[model samples]
Target: MAQAGFEDLVETFEFLDDWEERYRHVIELGKALPDMPEALKVPATKVEGCASQVWLHMTIEKGTLTFIGDSDAIIVRGLIAVLITLYSGLAIEEIGKVDVAGELARLGLNEHLSSQRSNGLRAMVARVVQTAAAAA
Candidate 1:
């Protein structure tokens, strides 16, 4: 399965005429996400405040941060994929300054998300940003 990048998602979203089609695309993105090892889904890496069980793992190598995440809810998983695309492989300085909520807004996802899902997404971004801040 081919993984879609952030720009790819934006283009696809723009191509879709309605929110339903965009939602299906998001689910497809979740389906294409690489599976996370069960061992990596421990409490230590779990994201708090999400309605679903979400785990985020961060690794730093040579000053670049990489993020991998999984969620029990399919939509949340798709949201995680978006977050990964935005944040992963970024330099510590870049990660520290990135406007994650703004990115979600630019994707038009923020307006479409339910309050619970939006809060969960915020939690996920917060965890990653915190990790980046500590690394920086």
Candidate 2:
């Protein structure tokens, strides 16, 4: 029910009338993420569906799962930050329980992104969900 990541992203994007500013804002958010662990930098965690190279790391703390990741592309890094914000700090069941595709639809970002990118983003989230489920 809390609008932490996706909602915030939509609100912010809407507030920015210019795509240039929105892009900058996203990059800033990506820059704000905590450093990715060295161990997580391995090729195994690299996301394959991205047009750019992306690395994701997952951690389980208490009952919640958190994610940290990086992308070689700036905008993609920001996008990854957006994904991390929404997907992180959620338990596997909670994540799987939520209508993720619906959330993205509610935010109306799916149409803004290319079909390939949209599918890739979904794939990344799916991998995160699978990883979390496996851990659970």
Candidate 3:
């Protein structure tokens, strides 16, 4: 099931008239993310395979998973926020059950993102899944 925040995002996307408005909204979402501490942007947290510099830090407590991520590019940061909203607060085992692709498609992201961005998003999802599996 989609998280409440993700569902709200989907609703907002539906309300937007065009991709341009959606894209701008995405940038605005990126702006809403709190700045990651410089110390947390270490090599271990850094995500590879992205066109822009990206990092994700994950934590699992009491069987629940949550993450914080950041990206140098504005649009990419928004994408990270989307991922955070989708995957954070899920149970460690439940992470594997979530259909990342299908859920993202609900927002028309699969059709709208550039090829490079799509690949990067996949890489980010892979990292999250790997982390969750290890924790579980």
Candidate 4:
């Protein structure tokens, strides 16, 4: 099964009519994310290239990858949720092959994102892909 919030997230985004609503939805997703343990937010998991402080923790079990992440910025946290939606719960090979940029583009999020946020999002995706590749 997909992660708890994954399918609903995509459906909600598709249902929203405009960027503003989508942005609100994304923020809401961030707000709804379960809090990561403070101990897990160490520098070893810190994501580079993000203007906001962000950390990613990935676990692989029976060939499926799972992720938990956090960010100081609300929108960045939402981007993390988006990354989780795009990449988590797949086999490592599937994660390495996912076209995250294309998916973001298809959602019309890439164009609307500020350059820094876009870079941050890319950084998070890169971390997930690289981690998946390691597991593979």
What's the lDDT for all of these models? 0.83, 0.75, 0.91, 0.83
Residue-by-residue lDDT tens digits, candidate 4, 33-107: 788899999998999999999999999999999899999998888888887887788888788677666677756
In model 4, which residue pairs have backbone atoms overlapping below 3 Å? none
Q: Write the per-residue lDDT of candidate 3 for residues 6-109, one digit (tens) a residue.
A: 99999999999998999898899889988888899999999899999999999999999888889999999899889889989998989989999999998888
Better of 1 and 2 by TM-score: 1
Better of 1 and 2 by lDDT: 1
- Which runs in model 1 stand beyond 4 Å of their true positions? 1-4
* Error at 129, model 1, angstroms: 0.2
**Which runs of model 3 end up more than 4 angstroms from their true locations?**
none
lDDT of 3 at 97: 92
Candidate 3 at 21: error in angstroms? 0.7
Candidate 4 lowest-lDDT run of ten: 1-10
Cα distance off (Å), candidate 2, residue 103: 2.4
Model 4 misplacement above 4 A? 1-8
Instruction: List TM-scores for all candidates, in order.
Output: 0.93, 0.80, 0.97, 0.92
The runs of at least 3 residues in candidate 2 whose Cα sits more than 4 Å from the true structure, single-residue gaps closed, are: 1-6, 18-20
Query: What's the true lDDT of residue 23 in model 1?
Result: 85
As a whole number from 0 to 100, the lDDT of residue 92 in candidate 1 is 77
